[model samples]
Target: MFDEKNIWDTFRYGDESSFKLIFEQFYTPLFNYGHKFTVDDHIIEDALQDLFVKLWKNKDSIRETSSVKNYLYKAFRRVLLRKLSYAPQVVGFSSPEDKLDFNFQLGHDHTLISQERLQQIRQSLSDALKKMTPRQREIIHLRYYEEMEYEEIADIMQLSVSSTYKLLYRAIETLRNNLSNTDFLLLLSLLSLKKV
Candidate 1:
């Protein structure tokens, strides 16, 4: 298995190869995480670029983190939020639903099942997710999709640890209530597809 601590230590030692590995491991996830907050590709790309650039520049001074993923996530969230604060109108959509941009894609074709059935499941999961409030959706994404710890999520979302757990629990409970057991299973599998 790949060890993040070892990779992080290597990068902190000013090894360019380790830095490249870290970037390759996290770029897509950071992009996806940022995309959940806003739809603007340019802003997300810029934030990611700034994040990596700063990481490389300050590698020697950066503290060793128990969870590098969590640290990066918190840093990325701060970068995006700070950028958005300067241009609040960028996310000035009237409703949380309007700001949502969740989409599900099937990884492969299923010969045993009709395409229509697959579509139905996909649609059902999407609908179920859409029904959630923006905060709820975010909590689910961080907690489930990102596999982040409650403390890490709390720090990123600016919530208390207890609040983070309650929020995630409520989001899962709401999703469970809205979806049938089979549909819930499909949603879980779909969300886990990319491991973030």
Candidate 2:
């Protein structure tokens, strides 16, 4: 298996090859994560560039990480949040003032699927997610849609491991309360597609 920690350690020791590998490997995930906060491609690109540039400049000072992905996520989150704070009308995932952007679109193919059923699925998923607060929705996304461990989610969200578990449980409970058995299963099936 590819050892991300070893690669991270090599990069920390000033290896430019390892640096390039990490940047290339993490760029897509980091970009998607940044997009959760803002739709602006420019901001997302700038934040990613700033992250890699700063890492290269300060590589020697960076410490070894047991989980390289989590470390990068934690750092990238801070930088993105700072940029989003300065930008007007950009809502962060934890922002309660803004309505939850819990998108649940089902792309249509030229199959025999009916539009009415697709719309119903979309509406139910959205309705279930909208019942939760933005913070709750975020925790659910990070835990399920992102397929992240509790520790990793905690590091990125700046929450404790226990808090991460509690928040995820609460978020799921809220969804369960709002959705019927069939709708909840449908929602969960779609969310679990990330693991596939």
Candidate 3:
């Protein structure tokens, strides 16, 4: 019933309804994704406005992509980065973690696991995640939380496919080294959940 290609085509044809539909469907996810880059909510909102403006203005010239989400994300990232590039040095922090925050949704569905055990695992996983570099955390969030493919993740992050794979591999390895077997398994289960 939900046809992305049709919606994208309609949007490209300058249908305001299609644009509104796309905006409603993607705004929250885009906002969350942008939050990973900067803490300022105002800046993120401004960037989204700019992204949509450009999307509508240049729709006729935009190339068709297999995934509309991918196209939007790539454009959004480029716009946000360009805006940040000219901003003050105070915005350009030395550490990636300073700009990126890692607060995974990590909801609790206590069907199989006890609440106490889940809490314990959450705390341990949080500690292990803190050990990873911000880029590593970003990859993990894109792969697991966003449920994005490696290629899409690579495109969004401006990395090669193999580099994205290796980055995720190293991030997972870091978590494995830091967490106990049980905790690692629990974390894996949490990561496997579909984003709701």
Candidate 4:
């Protein structure tokens, strides 16, 4: 596993290899995380690419006292928010269907998912997530899927630590209420069974 501090130090010292390592380690997860906010693949791709480029250009100025993952996520969130504000026309459409395929590709477990069942579960989860407010979904993703600390999440989300915990608590309650037992069970089963 890459030590985020070591990688950041290397990058700060002008090591090209460390930059490559960081990109390879984070690109897919960052892109998938970005997709939760928008269905446009190009937008997600562009946002992430731009973030990486900016990181590379500003490596010397970067100061991180926390995990590199937290830093990267915060940067990605900033880029996404800026894009959302700057290009409202590109991001304002509410087409849940547009993100369905990407959601499946990101979440599906090949070992557990037979072709048909995979498609069904993907659609189900995508629809369920679409029903959530963006903040709720973001809190859930950061807390559970990303396995981030509440303090780290609070920093990224610009909230107090207590508020982050409250947000996650409320989000989980909403998810539980909206998702049927079978769907919840299926998701939990997949998570437990899969290596992802």
Error of 4 at 139 (Å): 1.0
Pairs in steric clash, model 3: none
- What are the clash counts of all predictions, listed in order? 0, 0, 0, 0
TM-score quality measure for candidate 1: 0.74
Which ten-residue region of model 3 has the weakest summed lDDT? 90-99
Against the correct fold, how does model 4 do in TM-score? 0.75
RMSD in angstroms, all models? 8.1, 7.9, 7.3, 7.5
Alpha-carbon deviation at 114 in model 1, angstroms: 9.6
* Candidate whose lDDT is highest: 1
* Tens digits of lDDT, candidate 2, 118-181: 8766666677676776567777777877899888898889999999889988988887776676
The TM-score ranking, best first, is: 3, 4, 1, 2
Could you estimate the TM-score for every candidate?
Answer: 0.74, 0.72, 0.79, 0.75
Task: Give per-residue lDDT, candidate 4, residue 27.
Answer: 91
Each model's lDDT comes to 0.80, 0.78, 0.79, 0.78
Best by TM-score: 3
Considering only N, C-alpha and C atoms within 3 Å, which residue pairs clash in candidate 4? none
lDDT-better candidate, 1 vs 2: 1
Write candidate 4's Cα lDDT for 75-177 as tens digits. 8989987887788787533545445443335454568767766666566666666666778888878876788889999999989999998988888776566
What lDDT does candidate 4 reach at residue 163?
93
